[model samples]
Target: MAPSFGIMTAPSQVDYADVLRVWREADTVPEIEHAWLFDHLMPIFGDPAGPTYEGWTLLSALAAHTRRLRLGVMVTSNRFRPPALLAKIATTVDIVSGGRLDFGIGVGSRPSHPLARREYDAHGLPFHDAAYAVAGLAEACTLIRRLWTEDEPFDFHGTQHRLTGAFGSPKPVQRPHPPILIGGRSSATLRVAAEHADIWNIPGGDIDDVTRRSALLDRYCKDIGRDPANLTRSIHLPVSYDRPGDTRAAIREAIDAGFRHLVLGLPAPYPADVARWTADELIGPSA
Candidate 1:
């Protein structure tokens, strides 16, 4: 199958108008099949005091402004919100977008990054060890899916979370719920993705590393008796406005490595008509 392309605007250090403008423009461009936002409570890049909009809130607003592009947070941090609440929030966005939601989630950010770790303390959210985070992620995935698909209220008892009389009313617009796209390159995450994710995404930089991770995902899928091909491979590549050729090269390499779903990450302080520039300068030549 031919590859599909999309754009991601990290909601940091940029105003709402800027993001809305890009999404509105990308909505008119058929070559751009989807749009995304990253989930981070504080600025991971740029000045520490810079403005950063909460991801799902911004996504819901953007979803209302655009008509066509499939939209989602690149990968929501499972630690930021309870699984049941997230299920409802995702459902609302899907409804607002008229069913054009791609549900992306992960085990949250690793504590190793100082910038990322500070958010947990700043926001009073717990910072668990890697094993705990991955296990919680797996349980969250199972619970969230049930919340999206089950017809009646149900109770969930898991090591990480528990709920009683839980149910999602007005379930997501997408039948069987929106496609769950889990992002991460960790083996534990790959195992969860193999079981729960319809689409799997990882950041692009080292093509060989991502290719190896993809192979491991395939093995995990087979171990569980699931066909590896059933899960779509997705990658996020940063777009360099100064060097469109370099961006195109990365896109081509990712495609060569079997990533059919590509998300081109647009840096902040976007140029005028950036979406058009992306289509003309990067995507057009690459195709």
Candidate 2:
């Protein structure tokens, strides 16, 4: 199957409401199966002082405004929110969007900032340890899935998270639950995604790296007696420019390499412009 392509709508210093207008416009255009937004409290790239929009709020807005586009956080940090709460939020958003939600989560790589840096100190957690982060994220995913799918009350006791007597109301519109997409580029993340994720997204890995990691993931899936094909493979491209010519060649190459989805990162301040431009020049025309 030809891989599907989508846009990443990372908010800049621009007003939140305005971005929604652009997102609605972009959503109306064909060839965009999904629209992803970054989940961060502060700007990770571009100007350090540049404005950063929160991911979940933007996703909620997208859910309310758009009809066809699958809206989700490109990858939200599991460290920030309690797993149970995240599950409930995902369900609520799924309901709001009439079943168009993808919960893309990751062990965040960005360094902590001052305003929100206290979260680490509060939890007595090490901010930069990738191993610890991956473990915690895995535990969180386990808890979330249980909360979403189990009929009776369940208990989740883990070193990083513990939940008891939690019941989520009005299960997500998607059967079972909204698809879970695990994001990151590491052995731990690959193993976690192989074990649990419905989809796997890698932000900026090369094709060789992606192929190698995907093979590992398939091995893990097969070992567990699960069909590896059930797991969707997605690529998150960085700083893509939709120049003249076959601008979609990159997307096609990723598709040929076995990816099912392509999430393009939009440059700041003009994210909508870039997204719309890409759609008009590349996605719409090609489709």
Candidate 3:
């Protein structure tokens, strides 16, 4: 099957609810499955001091409003919330949305992003080294998945911390939990994805970069005795095409490189012409 082209709307510039609605309608128009939030506490490149909505809250509201659209954060920072609490919230939203959820997670360390750095400073979150954050994220992913699937309370010892009598309630609506989508390019991140991800997302990479990363991920899966094919591969690309052919080439390249899903980030309030064009033909192939 050809890859599905979903949208990830940045919540920094528009009313977040309106942003979700645009993609919710897009899902129906284009027969797409997933719609995402970029998971930033503040506007990144635009109006760094302006307001930005929380992804978890926005997702909950969207869950109530959307019926079939699978919702997710393109890549959520693990620093924003505790694993157990995040797990519970995700489960609740999954139930509310009738199981349309794709939980994508990643490390929170961002020394290069001024917006995230500002948030960390204001919120008193320690700015740890990249490796430290990725390691913590791995542990969080393990703990969150266990919380979603474990039937009995058990003591869980993570590298960074431990949980006692750990078990989650109302297990996620999707058995074994909603597909965990892990995103990043680093080796450590890929290993965690290989270990815990149902979908390993490659964020903003061209064909060569994506193929290389996919190969690296396969190596990690191999080291763990995992068949890389078991974990679906996806690409999330920032896109604005004056010509449909440009986006079409990108989509085809991703598919040919072995991605099963392609998430295209659009300009805020994705222009109707662009949306219709994508629905008509800009994706991987025949629509």
CA lDDT scores, all candidates in order = 0.94, 0.78, 0.80
> How high is the lDDT of residue 175 in model 1?
92
Poorest lDDT segment (10 consecutive residues) of candidate 3: 278-287
Cα lDDT tens digits, model 3, 1-287, are 55676877777778765676576676566456678887777778777777688887888888888777788987888988888888998999899888999998988647786566888877777777988898889889888888998889989777776889988998988987899998888888998999989998877656787798899999999999999889999888777666667767777777778887888777765665555556676653523
Lowest lDDT 10-mer window, candidate 1? 278-287
lDDT tens per residue, model 2, 1-287: 56677877677666777677667877877667788887766655556576777688778877998899887897888876878888988998999999999999998754544444543554564575777888888898888888888888877678887777878887899988889999876888888998889889886556788888888889888988889999999888754554535346656656777888888666545544655677776665445
Model 2 earns a TM-score of 0.88
Ranking by lDDT: 1, 3, 2
Give stretches of model 3 more than 4 Å off: 284-287
Clashing pairs in 2: none
lDDT of 1 by residue, 208-245 (tens): 99999999999999999999999999999999999988
Collision pairs in model 1:
none
TM-scores, each model vs. reference: 0.99, 0.88, 0.93
RMSD to the true structure for each prediction, in A, is 0.7, 3.1, 1.9
List candidate 2 segments past 4 Å from native. 110-128, 239-247, 271-276, 284-287
Which pairs of residues clash in candidate 3, taking residues 3 or more apart in a chain or in different chains?
none
Residue-level lDDT for 105 in candidate 1: 98
